[model samples]
Target: MTSYPMHTVDTAPAEARTPLTVLRETFGFVPGAAAVMANSPVLLNTFFSAFGHFRGGTFTPAERQVLLLSNAVANASEWAVAFHTLEALADGVAPEVVDAVRRGARPGDPRMAALSGLTVAFIEKRGHLGEADVKAFTAAGFGEGQLFEVVAGVAISAMANYTANVAGPPLEPAVEPHAWTAGTGAGA
Candidate 1:
């Protein structure tokens, strides 16, 4: 079903994959998607490296998860939301936070609400938010740095999501069971 064969380290090309080490070091297992992206590890590592750089910044880890979920929900990617939502909950976000995000209420939690608002504006405006929107989110207390991280989150998701859609990669055996109810590719 996947455009590229779902591959393990043994199947993926050997030399191109600093991402293999990057993912293994970060998550303790090389992610299936990372292995697939290893066809051109440049593609995988470019985004992964950008994520590592953003992740090293000022926002709390919880805030990062919020931004991740906001983008996933906006893309209507249940596959994305499912994995990231579990990560959010593990980081102590309430289940209501996920539910609120799904229903488009900005999720009530402050960090996530900011993320949700930013995500909605970015998607709806196609990345052209007005000055007032920036003022409003800044009013809500997300600093300029976190705002940038949110943008980075969207960028990373955009890359992985379109790849996954066209690839139709089978959900990783681990992430499979967490699939959520909304997505562009549901049952397709």
Candidate 2:
């Protein structure tokens, strides 16, 4: 197993310190994933930069969380599952919806279900969606451009999922209550 270092603002490499500080400020404490990622300045910066772009895109916070949660579930990332569950609810995704995602089921709300379903399929298909795949997403009221945005969201979340799963970051205190374990539905 790869052992990843969890760095804080003071301990992170020089290029990563500023972002670690920002993460500490934003989350009141830097998340374990960010802390582990801080060991690599390029990874830390690139992930956050992409995350920022994804956030600035058209998806609402709840929708964004849905995409993230779906990615976490698909990737079998327990840490991200816990974190995104909290973020989903904070962003106004219903408890049931988040729970459903954690359980690897599609969310109940039609729109959120569509979003989550599409995200899962995108990962499962490795981004090569057929016309029918595009139709299902668009029929759910997402624009064609938003399909591309969903890909962006998937990419952003996938990084966290892959990192946390590989590096095994300890859960942050705030996320302890929502801690998750990957089930049979998750990937390797």
Candidate 3:
């Protein structure tokens, strides 16, 4: 198996150092996956850029977690699943809702179900959303603009998810309790 270094802010490449430091300060610690991704300045920067845009998008924090967790599960990315599970819970998404998404099922909450359903379809269908998909999303009270926001969330999650799958970073202790295994979840 390939191994990757977990870089610290000071240890990261010059171009990656600032972002690493910022992430550390923002989250109170750098996520393990991001630490590994710091090996490639371009990859780390791209993640940061896309992530920044997604955070600034229209979704509330809980809604964003729903989309991101669904993306992680659809991509079968264990690390991202765990990380986003923690974030989802911290962001006040219902525990049942988080559990449902972690299990690759729709949430009991209608709005969350819509977000998860659309995000999974976005990844699973590779952006070829059918008319029914758009209709379901909009019918759930999401606007057409938020459909595009889901695209942004998916893009950000893909960067993190794909990196974690390839690099296999160790899970941070805070997220370890939520550790996931691909195929353990229904459609994961």
Report, for every candidate in turn, its global Cα lDDT versus the true structure. Answer: 0.69, 0.86, 0.90
Scanning candidate 1 in windows of ten residues, the lowest lDDT window is 179-188
| Top candidate (lDDT) | 3
Q: Candidate 3 versus the native: TM-score?
A: 0.96
Instruction: State how far residue 93 of model 1 sits from its true place (Å).
Output: 1.9
Poorest 10 consecutive residues of model 3 by lDDT? 179-188
Cα lDDT of model 1 by residue, 37-149, tens digit: 77776778787888888788776777777777777777776556666766677777777876677555677767567667887788778889899778777878878776676
After superposition, the stretches of candidate 3 with alpha carbons farther than 4 Å from their true spots are 186-188
Ranking by TM-score: 3, 2, 1
Q: List the residue pairs that clash in candidate 3.
A: none
TM-score of each: 0.85, 0.94, 0.96
lDDT (C-alpha) at residue 30 in model 3 = 95
Model 3 accuracy (lDDT, Cα): 0.90
Compared with the true structure, what per-residue lDDT tens digits does model 3 show for residues 81-162? 9999989989999999999999988999999999899999988899999999999999999999999999899988888999
Sorted on lDDT, best first, the list reads 3, 2, 1
lDDT of model number 2? 0.86
RMSD of each: 3.0, 2.6, 2.0
